[model samples]
Target: MTDETQIMEINKPISKTVVAIKRIDYVDIAKGIGIVLVVMGHNDFALISPFAHKLIYSFHMPMFFFMSGMFFKPDLPFLMYARHRFNRVLKPFLFMILFIYFASISFSNVGIPQASRRLIKALYGNGHYLDWVQLWFLPHLFVVSLFAYFFFQAVYRRGLFPLRWVILSVLFIGGVLGITLFWPFEPDILGRGFTVFGLPFSLDLVFVSGFFSSWGMS
Candidate 1:
């Protein structure tokens, strides 16, 4: 072989090494800690004081979102990325909801009509409308992940990586204000007063969750 071919062969391993990603131990440790905090936040244990519970609630979710963003890869085509997320996040969400709803109708005291009504409402994916309230986070998370994907693509496309946090910060502030100040669009359902805020998968929270993810990316 010629010198150029020999040189290329010699450099192949080094190139591969440069692109290889090493496992981050600290990230795993942090994720473990975050999982514990999430469990703590969800339970009303006598061991956990009210203040501690509040503290856990305040940061645990943000921590998860941030970590998710840290690993965000926006290089994939939009449809491919969406399909991956749908399989990872949305599929499980639908499965759980369907399983629970059908189980209730088949084996529990819930009548078919009642279960059907709830199943329909569950499509809204809001916490208030859900029977398994905690599951509401999944759909919202899916939306946030997609939003982050689009957002980072825009930033990279425009060469605005440096200003990404600035843009996200502004959006975060606006989201906070909007959620706190404005009343949700409360539409009555089932002849009872049901307040639904974020329709079609908690879109209202996209900005806030996107900010946390973007922070992780930075």
Candidate 2:
């Protein structure tokens, strides 16, 4: 067989296979645009004018998270929910981690020992060490989804809580307090004031996320 014919024969699976799925054009398009804005803001934040960066920063994440919240199925069965989280969030998170490990060790010339240490740290919230600021969102999103799921199940789903909205308000207030109150709790190393990062599990902004996600339920 000719080289071109042989190549075509070998590529039959990809070339001939097709799969179709329904999609909502507006939602998908809006989300695509939102993602572009966010990526542009992050990637070229410094290069772009400060005002433009500020504009993107102001709206992009809120829009993204709000859309995410809008899709959360609070009433989903526990097993299905767990499997969905695993397939969607955990899989991407693990893949990002593996990619980071390779990039740090090879492209960044970091040693395995140091890279592994950073990998562990990155799993929680330390993306700065790996120079991977973006992946921090993945873990934080997973945690926030879990928080919303449990909260929804306990209060709204069960119908056992009376002042649920009031409780939400109180928690929101407390979350605000937590952001300002980080330094006092930041001290760790031998009682020295080392200070925690901007947020843990994105809890500094958990109030915002929680609000939107909860809003999605109603």
Q: Say which candidate scores most in lDDT.
A: 1
RMSD of 2: 7.4
1-218 in candidate 2: lDDT tens per residue?
99999998998875665688778898799889998887787775757588888888877776766677778886688779878876887688778888978887899779999888877777656344335777767766776777778888878768856767787788778776776564334656876766556555565667766766665555
Error of 1 at 74 (Å): 1.0
Clashing residue pairs found in predicted model 2? none
- Score candidate 1 by lDDT: 0.84
Kindly give the stretch of ten consecutive residues in candidate 1 with the minimal lDDT sum.
179-188
Per-residue error (Å), model 2, residue 17: 14
For model 2, the stretches where C-alpha displacement exceeds 4 angstroms are: 1-20, 45-47, 126-130, 158-170, 187-195, 198-200
In candidate 1, which residue pairs clash? none
**Prediction 1 TM-score vs. true:** 0.82
Which ranges in model 1 have alpha carbons more than 4 Å from their true place?
Answer: 1-23, 46-48, 181-183, 186-195
Native-vs-model 2 lDDT? 0.73
Candidate 1 on 92-138: residue-level lDDT in tens? 99999999999998898999899989998898887867898888878
